[model samples]
Target chain A: MTGGYMGRILFVNLSTGEIREEVLEENICRDFIGGYGIGARIIYDRQAAGVDPLGPDNTLGLITGPLTGTPATTGTRYQAVGKSPLTGGWGDANSGGFFGPYLKFAGYDAVFFNGIAEKPVYLFVDNGKAELRDASHIWGKDTYETEDTLKAELGRGVEIACIGPASEKLSLISGIITRRGAAAARSGLGAVMGSKKLKAVAVRGNQKVPVADKERADRLRSEQIAEMRTPVAGGQSFIERFHKYGTSSGAHRSALSGDTPVKNWGGIGVVDFPEPDSLGGDNAIANLAGRAGCWRCPIACEGRLKEGTGEYRYPAGTRRVEYETQASFGTMCLNNNIESVNMANHICNSYGLDTISAGCTIAFAIECYENGLITRADTDGIEMTWGNHQAIVAMTEKLAKREGFGDVLADGVKVAAGKIGRGAEQYAVHIGGQELGMHDPKLISPRRPSQPSAARYQADATPGRHTQGFGPSGFRGHFLNAAGLCMMGQMAADPTKYLVGFMSAVTGWECTMDELLKAGERIANMRHVFNLREGINPIEWQVHPRITGNPPQEEGPLAGVTADIKAQVYWNLGALDWDMITAKPSRRKLLELGLDDIARELWP
Target chain B: MTSRGSCGLKPDSHRLNTSWYEGSRRGQEWKYCPMFRCVVGVFGLPREVTELREVEIELEDGARLRDIIAALRREIPALEGDIICAGEDRLTDNYAFNINGRFYQDENELQVRPGDRVALLLLASGG
Candidate 1:
């Protein structure tokens, strides 16, 4: 019955070319909640241990949170789940776009895709029905062309998530792009789709999100939109700057605070940063194109930049220059030119790849060449130097295709480092072989807030990163994996401190902060258990040796810093049971966590 | 030339002082940042409130946002809490302060400019 709220879940066995819809067990809803929580369960149950990450066995799932498509201002959030080809760990990446709302409109809580199709196929859903269609023609196209091709085939009303040539080749750092530029990037989940022979997932839904109390959801969303519109933030919030310049606006603040690393940390004069802006940083505003927002979100923090746009006149024009892109392509590569940053972001998006991993691998290559560990003969005879935008752009396209020197950096830092020896691996800063590298958080930097950058390298073992242990107001929080809602919305609404009762009313789960957090924790715990089944080591949670230095520097919060990691915190925090704040995890705690099947599966 | 030069450091440099605006604008910040920055535009008030002395509005902990109205009922009687934060939304206490013309959400130790106005507006949740 609709009374119990079992949003329909559709499963398409691609290898069998069969589509079937099922009513999900109410327990799945109660236990997993929504967003990455449900994503964790789906990946844990459907995926097999030691299954080649780039094979048909690695299931790719599209999921939405319970609050998705509801009256929440930032409610249109979605998640894609699979085993990461990048790190060989469980993959969970989410994005803010119209796809989540459309999934809810299609009258389904989730769509689980498995097995490899005989030919390239795109799954299309309208209202309550789903169909698998041929996508042979659009398979090798770039992300933007894929969407355009799908829209032309399925009508303009459809929303699609598609990959590019890089993904089809099973690149370890690939992503699914939506809204042309927004990415469900990282974790190499796109490789999973490529392996499954899936070209895209397109949907158009007109159905309403079933809410027990529509009035309450409306009131709450209205309240949140109002709270987020103010600007009294001491001009200190990166989110404010994020709205102004995507996430890259934070580069100025972090660099000013001296928390940013520049020119591969090989000492500054090589790239003009040993002294702050003795060279080319303040001139970066020339790259600021404008701002963008996600579906129904009020704080438009997504920046759309290009080189030739108005104030930022470098010919790159408005694409999207987020903070990590700036760090990786600008500071990390010693190419502080704003036009270079804009070009790098566009290159990553067009290639259907993760900007974080792509940037890090290239930076590592530059360092190796600089150290004379690798000669110009090894680098396609082109000198690997920082502040060289032309060299960086050429390499981005090359890496995606695994061509020339690009082939070495194609497998990400961990794998690529193994190929290029001679102390080169030390600077290839990645956590758990996945690159969600440490960056400055708002307010307190690394040391003052004690936010875990040291633990970041270990984050591949965590259930979901980027979405966990972040957001300034929440301080510490997790993503909601139900119908659909973005982390941006979750942070703005203060869900960690406030969404317990609010979520319970809509989903009828009667949730508390402890219960909500437990759901997030249980899902995270399930990820570790799933990764363990695949032979992953839990102790590898650490930052790069280059980052966790000896005689630590003396400037930022991370200045004079060293990391002290604890595996128990990683496991316990996943269950929302930190002994300092919450109760300890007793044997009875295992019983309280429920999911007896999961406990039996993990322990047995 | 932007240094404090011969300008004497005012008492309560961190407090509300409007007369600090009487001298050249370049010499205010002698030690750290010397620029006189304006508050963000989302405060729903005048960007340059020059007439006010020192405006101080206490910030409620973000953990207790729902309680801002009850706290404001006693602190500032000039406006009704219900009007500030409509029944559906609460815009009050989302911001820090104008501390001597510099708009700060929770500036804590940030310095203030002279002849400036401090107005409290809702702090934006930009993430």
Candidate 2:
């Protein structure tokens, strides 16, 4: 083993209660690096194509990268990978908290789960000794209560990744909630865990993560931290801003700049929501009770909001609403109330729902009501008007519990639109089945004829994610995620040069930017193969007309600017060496990336 | 000294088109001097410079946004090479400037006026 890895992968069969450990091959480690790359590769090789995403045949892999728990800045990240119940394709969601480092300390690189359990159970990995324990008492609880009960039962130091009532009920937008309010929130992977009757994964370990060279590792970490402290071209250093205001700091400005989507991507920012600054970073900071950071992260961008006094009152220790959550619940609903946004965030965290999808679905319902497609009778007598915070809160509960009309939206915006029928599909602003994130593609300049890179990023196999890292400067996310670094940290301190140095120190591989980016491209192609083999062709997938600027906004900063999606996809395919017509990675390109078998499988 | 086309206004006058006075100080002849003044608000500054959140700047008429940024940089040296480029050509990606609630992608072409509210905002990306 070079360094930075436990070199062990634990495989557990829930149906038969069989547990086994396999030594991680060094070649695979070197090629895939770790995290989602390793998880994607394993799932692709093991999972048969076209299996039901929520069936017993599907596998769930929780993985950590090389830099995780190794003194790397923002290294506390783990990826949950499986077939997405929402997208029905290659799905993965990454999160940060103490759980990943604890898993690493427990002496395992990854945990792979297959088959369905006969009863609700939780996995406990204690210093590498793993077992399944009955979780009948904790089955129906929310994530917060579940974590508290588990900690009381299994000691305070144990870290957990648990699903809430939403996941337990098989809500497709549910996510895995971890400690310090970190969530692997996307792709409906949490529901996959629920499908297997797995309630939580609790880990406690004292073993140290092995490092190749401690002195070199320490040096690299200090250098990166020091660089982070210095202000770059911006007047404020990213570290300082994060430490002070967190990610929601830009919410006010982003609303004005056409970055945050408003009213389900159908309304103009200034017109639909006036005084947007009320929901921005300043207001979020004002309500901050404290700040929290992921393991080994110095920025501590996670803000903790104070509990409110009356109707909006939530538990005081809840994490601050992130930018996406704020945009989703705030501008997307035509509501500028930060308190409501904060409460909505708390509800989603406790219930384990993807705030982006939930907010978008609610916006769709509101639009449906406005268009006279749905009435008060359809909304269970609650008026689905724009900016109705009460209705949003009420609908969120119903959705989490799958109660009444909430069951219609429990499957997500795509299925919900299909069921709603009369012109509701046009109201659903999503790419593929996943709801679009806050950023508008119209805000980004197209490199060529009206083709915005932002739109292309959203059109990837795992559609509707803003963080797919496909912008002109977004290639860095692939390397950053591979190395277990946070995107925020990368933005603050340029990861291009620092990641190369850090990788060399940890892996003793003398890594370079070119090699790191090549690995990223390889991982991306490998994921694309996973989708292709499962019959997901990116070329044929629909990009919502609203996102493509179909009619174009009549007024606003983005007026008359349409993202030429076809041209954009064509440009993206050419850049990635994918066949434009087939949307498949070229056999030559795959072979060059050392994916010879994948190339053959794709070609032959 | 030549009193060529002297407007009846003092040199220190804050008026928009105040004519020149004391022409002997420089070799070049002075005429009507059109000046543009505006308030610039700089947000997210460190605690040490928190009091310098807003500042008033005056510039020659027809001054582009770059000139206003240059003036601000000169006034607040700490802001130099931070949000504003060292050469004052454009804002760095880390920061964005908003004029009257509108975002200016190309600062070079933006023109400032006396009553314009130009805000220097720190650019933040998502988690």
Candidate 3:
């Protein structure tokens, strides 16, 4: 038996209503680790290429990493993997919450689902048993209501990851929501689940994930926690502001510094959205009802807002707005009404949609409206003007429900641009098909062609993603995700010191940094191979001119800076042994990473 | 303080006049030249790294960017080896240095005026 894995994978064919359990191979667990690493390997082998992302042929897996249920610090992560309807390529997104650990406790390391059910159904895995149940009663409910209803029926401890009405409508930007807030909200994978008529997966388990060296793992965890608690010699205590404000702590500063994209990648922050301190970190937690966090996470970087008392009324225990949501809704749209942004956050959370994509799409629509490509007639008489907080909130709800103009934008900027025609696509800023993250590439390192952020966005299997690193740094991030570790926790604790150490202790493998990095590289290559097999080469893709700073900004902090994103992609592709022109991994590099099967398949 | 590029030292950056040092030696104290005072804004670094929100640093006339790094290190020792390499002009990949709002990388010889605002922003990506 594998020490960290559940030794079992549950496969459910929704159309056939057949449920089967297969023993997970120890070698697969060791080589791929877990989370999307395992998901990628399995999907690349089992799922065929050129299949419709929303069709019965597409396989969607809710998979967890080895350390997910273990006592490892911040080990609450799982990956939702399948072909993306949005990007039409390899897709995977990770989320941190109680659902991942509880899924493992439900006696499976992963669950793969395919085929559309005859009716709406939710998969219930209680202890060692699994079955599909009719979900007709909760079919059209929001994520929160669905979770509440399920928890009332099944014991309260039953953790669930479910889609909302948005997904039921097959909105391409919809995401799976858990704990009423945490979401696996990328790659448009929730639409895949919705397409299968699968509403939710509720899990409750007591099974212990076997650890090779439980004592050593516990000891290492304690040591790391202590290290995190210890303050630096001369400076203030670390993690204080993060614990207090979460990611929101950097919102105002990041915007001012040109890190956060402003005016949908057009306007400058200090010039257009100055004095956004009301939407800053301090203000974000001001109305907090309490703090929240993922399973067993000590940092508890999440803030839950009290029910809104003033303008925008939301339910209590609403998820506090995060930096990305704020930047997307606040700076991108030039709307600084904190309450409206909070209301928008609540709307997105309830409707199970991606805030980054939803907010960015709104900003894109606003830009289109300003350019005369779209007008009030197209927007159902809404002004759709920049900084119109009321319009922003109204449009967000419409987007969630796919009503009126929102129907045109429900799929995201790329699709919306395609439908809008009349040169509206020029204002629709996106990398690949997905809307770009809040961080701007031009601000990353404008002077250097080998900028880190732009390189990742342009070169990774998943385009327009942030936080994932480039080269060895990226390998480490992949390994961390595969191991079910939180990136923020590792970053706060210093990954170099704790990541490999925790891996060795948990798996009883003498895992070194180099070995794990290689594993990460392997996982990265596997995802890239999946994309390549589907004929999606990011190398030939043209990035948006505004994102690349083609003409460069004229004013504010990032004035006169142009980022050569193509050069950055080339630099990263070279470092990763991917062809600069074809964007395929070299056969020798694949063999070096022990992907002999993939090498033979590609070469043959 | 005046902004960067306002001080006319870019053309003769390499040829240090040493007049300021000579003035000091002659018992003339360092004058408050607006060109020599840089307002440093520190954000995104963990509190354990620095509690300094903003700092105003005074440098001698004709001071290179390295001199400012040295001064910052002296003020915040916790920055040594992690944010800024110890006794080196190079900085770790953890943060980016923005001189008067323009992103600058590996430009140690760049001249700084007194009113320039140097922002040390943590390199953050993702949500």
When only chain A is evaluated, what TM-score does every model earn? Answer: 0.88, 0.97, 0.98
Of the pair 1 and 3, which is ahead by TM-score? Answer: 3
lDDT of 3 by residue, B1-127 (tens): 2222112222334322223332233466755433355666664442225655556665666787777677667656778877888777667665667775467657878888766657776555435
Expressed as tens digits, the lDDT of each residue in A1-604 for candidate 1 is 3322436888899999989888777777777776667767777776668887777777778888777777665667788887888777778777877887777777787898888999999898888889999989998888878987889878867888888888888888888888766788878888788888788888887787777766776677676666666543443343454465444444433443334555554332212443323122334444455666776676776655444653324333345666666767776777756665666677678778888778877887888887888887888877888667777877877888878888888878788888888777776766677764424221222212345443433443542244454112122244354435665445556664347535755665566777666665566556656776677654545555554444444432233334343532354344344233222223344567686775465445
Query: How close to the true structure is residue A424 of candidate 2, measured as C-alpha lDDT?
Result: 86
Ranked candidates, highest lDDT first? 3, 2, 1
Tell me the tens digit of each residue's lDDT in model 2 across A239-338. 8978887788766566655667788888877567746778876887677888888986988888887777668888988888888888888888888888
Task: List candidate 3 stretches off by more than 4 Å.
Answer: A232-236, A445-451, B1-63, B67-106, B110-126
What C-alpha lDDT, on a 0 to 100 scale, does residue A87 get in candidate 3? 91
Best by TM-score: 3
Complex DockQ per candidate: 0.04, 0.12, 0.22
Q: Which digits, one per residue and each the tens of the lDDT, describe model 2 over residues B31-111?
A: 655765565655443111434535666666666787766665655656666566676566665566656554564556677
Error (Å) of candidate 3 at residue A177 is: 0.7
DockQ ranking, best first: 3, 2, 1
Candidates sorted by TM-score, best first:
3, 2, 1
Accuracy of chain B in candidate 2 (TM-score): 0.68
Collision pairs in model 2: A233-B82
Q: Each model's TM-score?
A: 0.76, 0.86, 0.89
**What local lDDT score does residue A517 receive in model 2, on the 0 to 100 scale?**
81
lDDT of each: 0.60, 0.78, 0.82
